[model samples]
Target: MSDIEVIVGRIGRAHGIRGEVFVDVRTDEPGRRFAPGGTLRMGDKRRPATLASVRWNRGKLIVSFAEAPDRTAVEQLTGELLYDHVPEAELPSEKDEYFDRHLVGLVVRDHTGAERGTVSEVLHLPAQDVLQLDVDGEERLVPFVSALVPTVDVAGGFLQLADVDGLLEDVE
Candidate 1:
């Protein structure tokens, strides 16, 4: 199996007594990632399990594992993160879109071509995606938007942000 695992979801509280659990899906392609019969690795331990069923309730994804049969079994998986081994060559098909793995570790530059920081991580939020930057040891968050982040040169290993007031500057 590939070591490149992508976080697909996190197990939430149990929904019923039949071992079904709510999942906080992290991937954009939930239908494909959380499909039935799919193999998912549970938590940091990378324990393997197969998806026995997947359904939606009130717009939330509910999933059950073939290995878990009862509420007691699924309860143990609460708060556990789910991951799928994805190939490194696989990438988003959108022209400007990028995966969190691809965005992380890239150099962050300003509009004037001045280096600002490095992308420490990508935050997937409800409203939109955010970029966490390690700026001179301090952490700063920049929304992943075309208005602010105008350029993304993945091959060049850097992304440029617009020089907006208070965007990356110190606010007094």
Candidate 2:
């Protein structure tokens, strides 16, 4: 919704009769979704649906939109999203490291610095997050760990990784 300040989490399913939902967070940090008393916008760029209640469920966080006070209200948002506009001053980036958002649109290159493809999306797996890329008419899944992605220039919006050793062997 709106600009989606930031996706705090998502509504998984209806909880109990009172009102409850679940969130499968996609952030690099596991606990980023359950930041208590946060707000989420549904759609558009104006007033987002504020969150009234939030909790964790089976490692996933459950959030109740501030605007919804009943089970029916929560059910209506089962498939929608939650967002927050985190200020720049609040970013927790570290040296030689950048958030996954910065790598959304960048060219992936080989060790020789050859164009392999363009990154399309970033996936967060329980083990590790991977980059989904489209290269030379083929899709490539590159691991997003430090060993693979050794360098990330956030301002430049590009990523450089070590030679993917047999990384594509299984993909073949």
Candidate 3:
């Protein structure tokens, strides 16, 4: 298997006595990533497991793995990160869309072509996606919107952000 792994979800807590666990999905396509019969890796070690079942409960996802047969078994998996080795070629081809893996580590620059920082992470919120940047040892959360982030030149290894006053201000 490839060394590259894309984190898709984080196991929350054991939901029921039958080993079902709630998952905080991190991928845009939860249905595909958390689908039954899909295989997912756990943690940095990449422990392999196959999804025995997947279902929705109270607007959240509940998943069961073949390795986890009871609440006691799944409880041990709580807080574990789930990952899939999705190749770059399999990423979405829609214009102006990018995978989180592609965005991370890209240089961030202002409209005037001044270097600001590097993308450290991508936060997927319910309202919108945000880019987490590491600037001068400080973290900045920039909204990933067209108005604010005008260009994403992945090939060029950089992205341009519109200068928004107070947007990059340090937050306490």
Candidate 4:
């Protein structure tokens, strides 16, 4: 398999007997995130277990990993970051749309060709996805949209951000 970028779901805690884990999903696309018989990771450790079973109950996703043979083993993985590798073919196409993960590591720039910083992470909010930028020991949130972030050249590993008024002046 190709080395696809890891997409993180929420960290999970071991729940109940039977080696079940309660995972708080982070991705909007749960079907791909929790596809039955797929692989997932905890923290930096890549788990190569087939997903045995998964179900939603009480607003928490309960997943049974093939490697977690018993409740004791499940308890050890509590509160670990879960990562999944999703294939590009599984994603649907929308004109001019892109996955948020594709923006990571892209250099942020202003319209005047001023260098901003590299994107550290992407934050999903109710209204829009925010690009977390590490700018000189500080973090800034740039609203992910066409108006503010008008251009992105993933090939060049940089993006041109529209100068939002007061956006860079303050941190929220």
Candidate 5:
């Protein structure tokens, strides 16, 4: 399986007077990702960081790394992004759920088999995920939902979209 580095968290401010620091968790599976002994690459340098301890304060995730033993050391790590390398073959446990990377390169077509565009990016908004389509060099954003994106065939390398008026407006 190919490996993909995913951002799991970002180091926040130092917590209390120890090396423990608040983490702005980015992954849904924080328990598994931030579990003690789990190794996460820290920052753009990709420094190896082993989780020494993890706990929750109120609703915030507080973590300490084996490499950063004291407040001084952990403070330096503030604002650093934590990344976890995982297999690209891994799929979401639930059906129909797709990782952004999986959809990025898929061809988008209309229901009647009209070629439309290619998915270039996936934008995660508070309400829902949005697909960024590159149609004839023009960019369009489509909300990622069953109503709009009716079908997805990752293996087939394509996805079918429902023909809503104005959806493919200026294109055809």
Candidate 6:
């Protein structure tokens, strides 16, 4: 239950008859996250399951765990989230790359130094990620791309957002 554990995937429906399950991956690095022998923590239960095998099916990752050996066993894992229980420090160090967990709860500010709100959530969309903020009790969706976000100072505890016209307007 540590904050350091990052969600790597969510178990979908059973893929085939041999206990293989389709995973809706959340991480950018699927090969590492879903690799054989990698251990993933299951949702709520926090049960550690080792990846016994993994295969790519039409760009989707179908995985089998040692704990789940049949379709019936994999069925129990449907809708469960898979997390990589690794410390943030152990993650790859790359410029401008950040885990969504680090951005949550950070104060979001406009380029003019005006406080917009606090980050409530981080939405990972197919095209890009978004920062969901709570401003004056209203929700705002801000694209997390460099062009709009510009800066993220986790140590400083704030996110600097570029001024995009009507970007902070109330959602209708």
Better of 3 and 5 by TM-score: 5
Top-down lDDT ranking:
1, 5, 3, 6, 4, 2
lDDT by residue for model 4 (1-172), tens: 4556555565477777898888777776677778778887766666565578888897778888888867898788777778776674444354565566667888888788788788888888879888898777689888888998888887688888886775565635
Best by TM-score: 1
What stretches of model 3 exceed 4 Å from their correct place?
Answer: 1-3, 125-127, 136-138, 168-172
- Candidate 5 has an lDDT of 0.89
Note the Cα lDDT for every prediction shown: 0.89, 0.67, 0.87, 0.76, 0.89, 0.86
Off by over 4 Å in 5: 56-59, 170-172
Off by over 4 Å in 2: 1-4, 29-34, 43-47, 87-90, 93-97, 165-172
Instruction: List all candidate RMSDs to the true structure.
Output: 1.7, 3.8, 2.9, 3.8, 2.5, 2.5
Question: Mind giving the per-residue lDDT tens digits that candidate 2 earns over 1-172?
Answer: 2332556555678878777777667555535545557555664443467667766657667666667777898887776765666564354545555555667888777677776677888887778778988777677788888888887766665677687675433434
What range of 10 consecutive residues in model 1 has the weakest lDDT sum? 1-10
Which digits, one per residue and each the tens of the lDDT, describe model 3 over residues 1-172?
A: 3456788999999986999999999887787688799899997788987999999978999999998899999999889999987766566656678888889999988778888889999998889999999887899899999999999998899998887775566445
Better of 2 and 4 by lDDT: 4
Q: Write the per-residue lDDT of candidate 1 for residues 67-143, one digit (tens) a residue.
A: 99889999999999999988887778667889888899999998899998999999988899999998788898999
RMSD of 4: 3.8
Estimate, for each residue in 1-172, the C-alpha lDDT of model 5 and write its tens digit. 6899998889999987779999998776787689898899998899999999999989999999999999999999999999998898987777898877789999989889778899999887779789999988889888999999899999999999997766656655
> Lowest summed lDDT over 10 consecutive residues: which window, candidate 5?
163-172
lDDT of 1: 0.89
Tens-digit lDDT track of model 6 for 1-172: 3447788999999987999999999887787678899899998888998999999989989999999999999999999999886666554456778777778899989889789799999998888888899988899898888899888898899988887776777445
- Give the C-alpha miss distance for residue 99 in model 3, angstroms: 1.5
Q: TM-score for every candidate vs. truth?
A: 0.92, 0.76, 0.84, 0.70, 0.85, 0.88
TM-score of 5: 0.85
